[model samples]
Each structure stands twice: as structure tokens, then as C-alpha cells.
Target: MKYAVIRFPGSNCDWDMYYVLRDQLKVEPIFVDYRETNLPIDVVAVIVPGGFSYGDYLRSGAIARFAPIMEDIKKFAEAGNPVLGVCNGFQILTEAHLLPGGLRKNQHLEFICQQQDLFVQNNQTTFSNQFKPGEKVMMPVAHGDGNYYCDDVTLQQLRTHNQIVLTYSKNPNGSVADIAGIVNEQGNVMGMMPHPERASELVLGGTDGLRLFQSVVTRQLQK
Candidate 1:
């Protein structure tokens, strides 16, 4: 299976995610430029890395949604291919309608950059397969527009489907119900505000984030 990581003009974490998949996880990484109209035919999965795309001008991810490649990304996701969106990538997913809900400014209206404790909510999906439900893990998050919002009814549906993947242990961003990450109904698409790639190296802090990338490779092997 081939792994493709999207690269937008202002993407800064693209290389970090690329290294995580290539050097750390030992997977061949394909960087897909945002200008490209299509994903490689063999691409079996994708990672939309974090960064202030288009400088977050018209609002985070607002302009990126119109990129020609976004349409293909959505179609690829609908075909059940694994899709992981991190930070600004999460914003893009919401903007592109691949994931439900929107990410607004942090409750404090400040850019928060620090390690956050997260509790695993659901480990049944491809993205969380390596984790145990309710387990605590620490990952770094850096963003201003990280608060997640959605209607109460949609939130209830998310709960009913067990779609919530992770919850902030300390509610750092004031997201509803303290949600930190979530998966689509099909479980192939997931969006999280944390920078898992930043924590993939033990020397930096912990390798807890490595499993997330491994989860993708493991799931591919299962198929």
C-alpha cells in the first residue's frame, strides 16, 4: 500500500509527518502537492499534515477547500481509504466537508502550544487500533483555531456511533464535551488537533505517537 501526504503552500509540518512515515515507520512516503489534481493511483492512504495553509487568511482551511486536489481527496476517503488529518489539516477536513464540525478560535483566543494529555475514547477504528480505550497519552498541540464545535443533535449522533476517538483530559481548548479527535462513520477518516508526528521520537519526549502511523500500516497488512 502506498501512503501519500498532502502538502499545501503554507504547510510547515509536512516534512515532519513525512519523516515520521518514512524514517520512523519505514513506509515509503509520497508528498502530494496541493496543486496536483489527483492522488497516485496506487495511493492507499493519506495524511493531511498540520500548518497554516494559505496563511489561514480567509479563515483556516477556507481557501484550501477549493484546491482541485480536495475533490479527489474526498472521493478517496469515501472509497474507504484511510485518511488522517492533523491540526490545520483537521481544519481543512472540516472545511472540505470530509469531517463534521468546525474548528474555531481557541476559547482563550490565544495560540496555545504545549503538550496536552488526551484520553482515548474509542480504539476500534483503524486510527486508534493500537490504543486501549480510556488510556491516557500525551501529545503536543499548537494552534489558535483548535476549538471544535457542532450542533447538539450531531454531537449526540457522534456519541451514539462511538465516533469520538479522543478527549482532552484537561479541556485545554474548550471543545464541546472536551473532544480532541474524531473518526468518520466509516472509521477510515480521522481528524485530530494534536501533532502526533512531533511526539513520534522518544528522544524528543515519547514515542506514543508512533503507533498512530503504525496503525495505518497494520491495517493495510490486515487487508
Candidate 2:
């Protein structure tokens, strides 16, 4: 199967994501430029990797959200295809309204980069089926604006629908309810602050993130 990795002007981790999908997952990964208006027809999944897109101008993902390819992405997502967004990609998803809530400056107003432990709150979704509920996995988080915020009602809705998928073992960026990752109501799209690609190899410290990619591949194969 094929996956699309969207590359923006300042996307530094696109290759990292490509490595995970192409080498580790043994899947074809197509790099879709932000300027492109469509994804390859054969792609079964889309990955919006982490980076400082558009130099993070006007806010983390405010500018990148308007990239030409996002319209097609939105449509692809609406059709029940899987889309995974990490860090800056997560911010872009929220900006595009593909997901709810916004990422704000870290509570301490400083950039943070470290290994973080996250609890799997819901493993029934496509992005996390390899994990057991309440499992703790370690992944690296590097961001200056990773604090997630949403209104009270939204939080309640998220809880009600089991949309909150991951929570920090110890609140890292002061994200509400310790949210480290979340899925959309339809459960096909997921957004998270941690860099799973960075943790997918044993040399990188652990392989906790590998299962996430495996889960996606398994889901596709089953279909």
C-alpha cells in the first residue's frame, strides 16, 4: 500500500516520516508537495509530519493550513480515509477545522524536546489498535507551541465519544486533561504532539511508536 507524506516549505521531519513508512513499515511513501492540489490515487493513508512550516509565521499552522493541497486532504478525510498529523501537522489540522481545538504556546513559553510518556486512553481506533487501553508508551515531543486547548463543551464531547486517545503520563506542555493525542469523531483522523517516527526504532530509545504505523497498515490490509 502507499501513503502520502505532505511536505511544506519548512517541513524538516517529512523525511523521517518517509523513512518510517517506507523502510520500517515497508510501504511506498509518496511525498506530496504543499503546492500540489491532489494526492496520488493509490495512497491509502496520509501523514502530515512535524516541522516549522512556513517558518511558523502568524502562529504554528495558521499559514500552512491554507496550502493548496489541504482542500484535497479535507475531502479525502471526509471520505473516511485515515489521516495522521503530528506536532505542527496537528496544529494545521485544527486550523483547517479537520480537528477541533488549537495549540498554544507552551505553558512555560519555551521550546521543549524530550522523551514523554503517554497513556493510551482508547485503542479501538485505527491509529492505536495495536495498543491496549491504558498502556503507557514513550515518544519524543519537540515543540514550542504544543499546549492543546479546547472549550469545556468540546472536552465533554471528546470524552463522550472516546475521541481522546492519548494523555500524557505527566502533563508535558500543560495540555488540558493531559491530552497528548486525539482522534476525530469519525475516528479516521488523529492528531498528536509527540513524534512517533522518532521513537519507531530501537536505536532511537524505543519502538513504542512502531505499533501505531503497524495499526494503520493492518487496518488497510483487513479492508
Candidate 3:
């Protein structure tokens, strides 16, 4: 299974994500330049790793969403391939319209970095299939614009559809409904504020994030 990690100017976690795939997961992940026009056809999955893309110039992920590679990434996602967006990557997915809602500055307007416990809300999605519903997983999160917001009806719709994949055990960013992650309608795409890649290895403190990647591999192989 081929994976592509999109890299933008200020994307700092690409290497961490790469190493997680290559060394830990033993899957080769291509580093695709955000400026690249065409994507390799064999790319079956794409991860929009975290980092302050474009230094969060105009808004986190607002500018990076327009990168040349996004068109191909959109095409890949539309074709039912799994697309996992982490942290700023989650913001980009929202900006790209792959996911609903937008991430806003923390209600407290401060950058928060700590280990958070996330409750798995839905396991049907390819991203969270390895987790049982209501399971709590620990992962590190570092961001300022991790507050998720949407209209009341939209939030209701998401809950009704089981679109919410994860929720923070405690309100960390004051996100509406405590949403920490959500998947698209098709379930092929997911956007989350927590850094799963950062928690993939035991050295990182916990392996709660490993199941996310493993879930993708498991589902892909089943197909």
C-alpha cells in the first residue's frame, strides 16, 4: 500500500510522519512536494501531517490549502482513498472542503501542548476502525487553532450521522460539542486536531496513535 505525505513550506512534521511509516510501520511513504502538479498513481493513501504550514500566515492552513498538490489530493480522496489530516492538516482539510467546519483559535487564545485523552466515537470509519467505540486513547496535541466550530444544526447532523470520530475526554480547546475529530460523509477522509503520528512509537510515550495507521493498513488489506 502506497502512501503520500504532503509537504508545504513550513510543514515540520513530514519527516516524523515519514519515519513512522518507513521505520515503524515498514511502509514506504512518498514525500510529495506541495507544488507538485501530478501525484503518483499508486498512491493509495495521503496524510496531511502537522506543522505551521506557511507559518500560519493568514490563518492556519488557509494558504496551504491552495497548494498545487491539493488538486491531486482532492482527486485521490474523491476516489475513495483514505486521507488523514492531522493538526494543521486538519485545518487544511476543512479549508479544502474535504471536511466540514473550521478550526478557530482556542477560546483561551493560547498555544496548548500536552497529552490528551480522546474518546473514540465511531469505529466504522477506516481511520478509527481499530478502536472500539468509547475507547479512550492518549495522544499529544500542540496547537492554538484547534477549536472546532460549526452551526448548531450542522453539529447535530454530524452527531446523528456518526460523523464525529473522536471527542476530547475533557474540553481542552473549547470546541463545540467537544469534537476532537471527524470524518467525511464517505468515511475515506478524516480530520483531527490531535497528533496521531507523534504518538505512533513507544518512545513517544504511548502507542495510542499506532492503531490509527494500523487500521488503515488493516482495512486496505481486507479490501
- For TM-score, the strongest prediction is 2
* N/CA/C clash count, model 3: 0
lDDT of 3 by residue, 104-184 (tens): 999999999999999999998899889998999999999999999999888988988889999999989999999999998
Best by the lDDT measure:
2
> What residue runs in model 3 are displaced by over 4 Å at the alpha carbon?
none
RMSD of each: 0.7, 0.5, 0.8
Model 1 agreement with the true structure over 1-223: per-residue lDDT tens digits: 5789999989999999888888998878899999999999999899999999999998999999899889899999999999999999999999998889999999999999999999999988998889887899999999999999999988998999999999999988889999999998888999999988998998879977888788888899899
lDDT of 2 by residue, 8-42 (tens): 98999999999999899999999999999989899
TM-score of 2: 0.99
lDDT of each: 0.91, 0.95, 0.92
Off by over 4 Å in 1: none
Q: Candidate 2: what lDDT?
A: 0.95
- Candidate that beats the other on TM-score, 2 or 3, i.e. the better one: 2
Sorted on TM-score, best first, the list reads 2, 1, 3
Query: Where does the lowest 10-residue lDDT sum fall in candidate 2?
Result: 165-174
By lDDT, the better pick of 2 and 3 is: 2
